[model samples]
Target: MKILVVDDDIHILELVSIHLRQAGYTVVKAMNGLEALKVVDREWPDLAVVDVMMPGMDGYTLTKKLREDTEIPVLLLTAKGEMEDKERGFLAGSDDYLVKPFEPKELLFRIHAILRRYDKAVDRMIQVGPLLINRQSYEVVLGKKSLLLPLKEFELLSVLASRHSQVFTREVLVERVWGFDYEGDEQTLSVHIKRLRDKLEKLTNQVKIVTVRGVGYKLEVSE
Candidate 1:
């Protein structure tokens, strides 16, 4: 697979590119966001590793531009590790975020995880009655309306909708949706499920999230 490395700092850019090459990935280098876009147009790399701080367009803007045009996954490599920074990166359509001064191994691991998630969801479309879930675009359409959801909520819904009527255990759902390394308890999953349920209920009566007494949740679609 080909990977694009975008960073204003020459040393950091080279460092990331070398690591990706060592992992058997073809590497394309770009100094800034504009150059990165040009490289994207030419190289058509499978994924991009971008630095948040750049000279012209920042990583967030570049991510938005890429999302607007392509389904290529983006991993934001930034020094900003705060919650708000991570939130901004995700909101800008980044597939994942890693704070700077990170281990190359960790970076590779995140890239693999993102790629695996994308592979599983690529071209996958789930329809339940009037509700439609397009995994590639992260879009949820109910009847004639599109419902926007936060990243986690969207992921949770996709997981359930992929296997509607199957009773998924809380542990399994949490692992699949939030990752096994998630530090929070099951309450986080519950909260997101609640939000998804509320949103679906507000839009349609045919699709429902049913909670099993001892188990987790299942999505039910009525014709």
Candidate 2:
């Protein structure tokens, strides 16, 4: 997987890029928000690690821009340990937050945690007939064929499948799939749900993620 590291401090950027590369991921470096944006447009990384403070544009602004176009996971690095700073990061669409003066292991752990959450979101693939989900690999197999899913779509499916018959409100899905402390609009969950439904249609004609109208949604085995 490809990771982008955006920071004004060259030393910090180098340190993070080196460690990410060592962990078997391709690393892309950006010095400021503008540079990060350009890199994102060109490379389309699997994930991004951004520093809060910068000269050209701040991490918050960059994160907002990225969210408008993509659902790539973002991990914010903030020097300020204030609650306000952390809240601001979430409000701007970051998936996770890490305070500065952090150990490399902690950074690695956060990245792994985010990836693991993405994986867990699809921990089970319910087969109600022709549908098949390989929860371990996040692969959806449909009658001897497989479909490729984006990260958010995969996460959304996982969340619904894990609960099976249980209904989940949009608020719960946003918190569970995004993060417990996420502050983005609830509509983001709708977008992901729509995408998942569209993809699942290719496998089966049934509605796997059922809308519960006044309640929320449930993944039911089609009758």
Candidate 3:
């Protein structure tokens, strides 16, 4: 997962980035809220760690702006420990808050907890007919058999299974499975869908990935 860390303090920015990287996350840093917003447009991080106090565009404003268009989770960091400050942070749409001078381990724990909560809320486990897609474990199981798929293919399946029988445009699928900045063409999507169909055919015919002619694709689950 990717994390964006915004802090006016150079030392705090580097410290947080180093710890997040050590915890196996891609880290992007910004010195202020304006820079953080720019980085977010370019990076599309899964979460953001923002310092509450800044010269301009304070963390509260930044968090509110982020929540306006995207659901990216925010964790506020501040030196203030008062309840009012924390309440303001929450009202700004922060998923969690951490006081400064915090232990690195505690930061890591909170990040993990926030991510888990998001995962649970965003399709942690999806069941479509006889197929099971476990987002938490990244596993796809059909009855007693497990289907091993490449990461992209698995992500594609997960996206489709998240909303069974829902039509997803090729553009939308590409953006979700591959990043918005993906350079590949729709052929990449076609190939993956073909592979997924072949795999499913070998196992069971209960589920099918059907192309909606001029529209897109949908996962059809039969009873």
Candidate 4:
């Protein structure tokens, strides 16, 4: 899963990212709320780890802005441990809240809990043309065949299928699928797209990931 970590402290950001990456999560970092918004505009991470204190925008406003458009999970990780602060975070749409000096294990546990709950409540099955993606099952069916795909590839396809015909820039695609802080270049996305294309070609030729030249790519359904 992809997680966006927002904090003014570089040490905190790095510490959090390290632990999250070690736990097999793609980590995206933002120094403050402004950068967080830019990252969110393109990335749409599965969850956000935001600190309450910052220079430009505080965590409360950031959470509020995020809740305005997306239902993506938000977890407030801050130094404020007061009951009032926790209540404010909840009111701001934070799904979970953890104070500073927290154990990394506890953080991980909370993340898993939130994700599990969200997955259960959400309808993750998506139908795009002849392809059917069961995210909860981590499987995809094309025509009559059930195909197995690597995690990243499956997620990439899921994102593309989620917004059929909408062109996604390489940057946007990487942010959404691989996380905004992905270390690989655009070549990585190309490789995955190629692999997806090869597998998809075996299924049929009606649906395609169309390249839009200067723009990026779009899922083209020939009907």
Output the number of the TM-score-best candidate: 4
lDDT of candidate 3 over 1-32, digit per residue (tens) = 78999999999999999999989887889999
lDDT, model 4, position 86: 97
Native-to-model Cα distance after best TM-score fit, residue 69 in candidate 2, in Å: 1.0
Please list the C-alpha lDDT of all candidates, in the order they appear: 0.87, 0.81, 0.89, 0.88
lDDT of 2 at 19: 93
Model 3 whole-model lDDT (C-alpha atoms): 0.89
Itemize residue pairs with steric clashes in candidate 4. Answer: none
Overall local distance difference test of candidate 2: 0.81
Q: What is the TM-score of each candidate against the true structure?
A: 0.56, 0.56, 0.63, 0.69
Q: What TM-score should be assigned to candidate 1?
A: 0.56
Residue pairs in steric clash, candidate 1? Answer: none
Q: Report the poorest 10 consecutive residues by lDDT, candidate 4.
A: 176-185
| Model 1 residue 101 lDDT score | 96
- Report the number of backbone clashes for model 2: 2
| Candidate 4: segments with Cα more than 4 A from true spot | 125-157, 164-166, 169-210, 219-223
Q: Can you write out model 4's per-residue Cα lDDT over 120-191, one digit (the tens) per residue?
A: 987788888877889977788876789889999888888788777877888878887876577977799899
- Minimal lDDT window, size 10, model 2: 122-131
